[model samples]
Target chain A: MKHYNIYVTSKPVIYDPAGRASENTLAKLGFSGIERLRIGKFIEMQCADDVSLESIKQMCDQLLANPVLEDFRIEIVD
Target chain B: MSDFRFGIVVFPGTNCEQDVAHAVRWLGHQAEYIWHQDTTVSQFDALVLPGGSSYGNYLRPGALAAASPIIAAISEYAAQGKPVLGISNGFQILTEAGLLPGALQQNASLTHICETLDFYVEKTVCQWLQLASGTMISLPVSHGFGSYYADAATLIQMESNGQIVLRDTQARIAAVCNEQGNVFGMMPHPERACEVLAANHPAGAGGTVFSTIVKHLEVVR
Candidate 1:
C-alpha cells in the first residue's frame, strides 16, 4: 500500500475570500504585519503500490481539484 | 399552448427538485425528476439542474455531483444543442463538469447571503434570456459560494465568444452560457422567485427566464 497527500490551493488569479477573512481576524487579535494568508485543502489517500504519479495526476485533474480555479501539489508518503 | 417537458436533475443532497418541477408545471409544461445515477436526459425537451447543495457541498459546491452519471448524460444532451439551465448550486456543477466556463467561488465577504438580487442582461445571444440588452430582472440569490471567477485569458475568450449573458449591479457575473449558447448557468434561484403575486407580477422576473427557456425550446423543437 502507498500513502499520498494532496495539497490544493486557489490559483493566484482567484480571490481567497475565506483566507482574507481569517487574516482580518488575525489582525484584530493583534497579529500585525502579516503580509498574506491563504486557506487550502489537504487530502490524504491510500493507493496500491502499482499506482503511478501520472495516474494520480489524472485523479487530481479529474476530481481532486478544479484546474480552472485551483492548483494542487501531491506528495508521496514514505 | 406549447407544452414543453423539463427534466430536473436530482442528486442526493438536492432540495430544489420539487420546487423546480412545480414551477415547470405552473408554466404549463411537463416536468420529471432525473436521478444522479440515471444515464439519459434526452427524453425531455430541456434539462434543468436546480438549486441545492448537491452531495452536501462538502467536497466543494458541485465537485461530487459533477462526476455523477447524469452529468455525463447532460453533456451529451447539451452537445445536441438543446437548452439546459443551471440555477444556484447547479451553476457550480455546470462549471465543475466543464459544461460552462468559470468557477463559482466563495463570496467576497466569505459568508452566506440569501436575498433577492437585480440581474442585468448584457448580451442577447443566449436567446433564452429572451430579454434585450440593458434589461433588468430580479431573482432570489441564495448561496455561500456565489463569486464567479475565471482567469483573465478565459474571460477574454468568453467575451469574444459572447458567452457572458448577465451581471449584477456590482458587475459580478450573474449568468453565463456555453460558447454555443445552448446551456446557461447562474447563481440565482428562479424557482424561488416564481409566481409571487405579492411582487406585483404573477410569474415574477425569475419565472420569465425560467419559462422563456422552455418556451424557446418549444419553438425550435
Candidate 2:
C-alpha cells in the first residue's frame, strides 16, 4: 500500500477566521512576533501500489477538497 | 391545503428537516422528508435542503452531504426549473454541490452567530421570494459558517446576473439564486420565522415568504 498526505486549505483570498481567532488567543497568551497562523486540514490515506497519483488528485479535486473554497496538495513519501 | 408537494432532503446529520416540513405544511402544502440516500426526487414539486450540521459537519460543513446520492437527484430536479430552497447548512450543501455559485466560509467572528437580523430582499432572478424589491424582513441566522465568500469577479457577475437574492443590512450577501432562479440558497432560517402561532407571521414581512412559494406553485401548476 502506498501512503499519501494531502494538505487542504482555504484559498488566500478567503480569510481563515478560526485561524485568525486562534492567533488572537495566542497573542493573549503573550506569544509575540508571530507572523501568521492559518488553520487547514491534513488527510492521510493508503492505496494500492498500482493506484496512480492522478487518481488521488482526482479524488481530492472532486470530493476530498472543495475547489471553490480550498486548495489542496498531495504528497507521497519515498 | 394544496396538492403541491415539497420534499425536504435530510442528510444523516441534518436537523432542520422537520422545521422546514412544518413550515411547508403550515403554508398548506404536502411536505415529505427524503433521506439523502434516496436516488429519486421526481415526485416532489419543490425540493428543500434544510439546515443542520449534515454529516456531522466534518471535513467542513456540508462537504460530505453535498456528495451524497440525493444531491445528484436534486441537481436534475433543479435543472427542470423546479423550486429548490436551501436554508443555512442546506445552503452550504447546495453551494458545495455546485447547484449555486460561491462558497460559504466560517463566520469571520469564528463563532456560531445566532441572532435575528433584518435582511433586504433584492429584485433578482429568485423565484422563491415574491416580495417587493428592497423589502426588509426579519429572519434568524444561526451558523458557525455563514459568511459568504466569492471572488470579486464572480461576485460582480452574480450581481449583474440578478443572482444575488438577499443581503444583510450591511449589504453582505446573505442569499443567492442560480442563474435560472429556480434554486435559492440562504443562510437564514425562514422556517423558524414562519410560525403560524407567532403574531408576526402572515402579517410580518418575512413571515409571508413561505406563503409566497405556495402561491408560486399554484401559478406554475
Best by DockQ: 1
Report the CA-based lDDT of candidate 2 relative to the real structure.
0.85
lDDT of candidate 1 over B18-134, digit per residue (tens)? 988988888788999988999978789889998889989977999999999888789998998998999888999999999998888888887799878788987656756855457
Specify the poorest-scoring 10-residue window by lDDT in model 2 chain A: A9-18
Measured on C-alpha atoms, candidate 1 has an lDDT of 0.85
TM-score of model 2 vs. true structure = 0.95
Cα-based lDDT at residue B48, candidate 2: 88
Q: Which portion of correct inter-chain contacts appears in model 2?
A: 0.76
* Candidate 2 lDDT, B39-150, residue by residue in tens: 9999988888999999899887888998898888899989999999999999999999999998998788777898888888888878888454668888888999888888
lDDT of 2 by residue, A1-78 (tens): 899999998888778878888898999999998898989999999889999999999999888988888999999963
Point out where model 1 deviates above 4 Å.
B197-203
Q: DockQ of each candidate's interface versus the true one? A: 0.89, 0.80
RMSD of each: 1.7, 1.8
TM-score of chain A taken by itself, candidate 2? 0.96
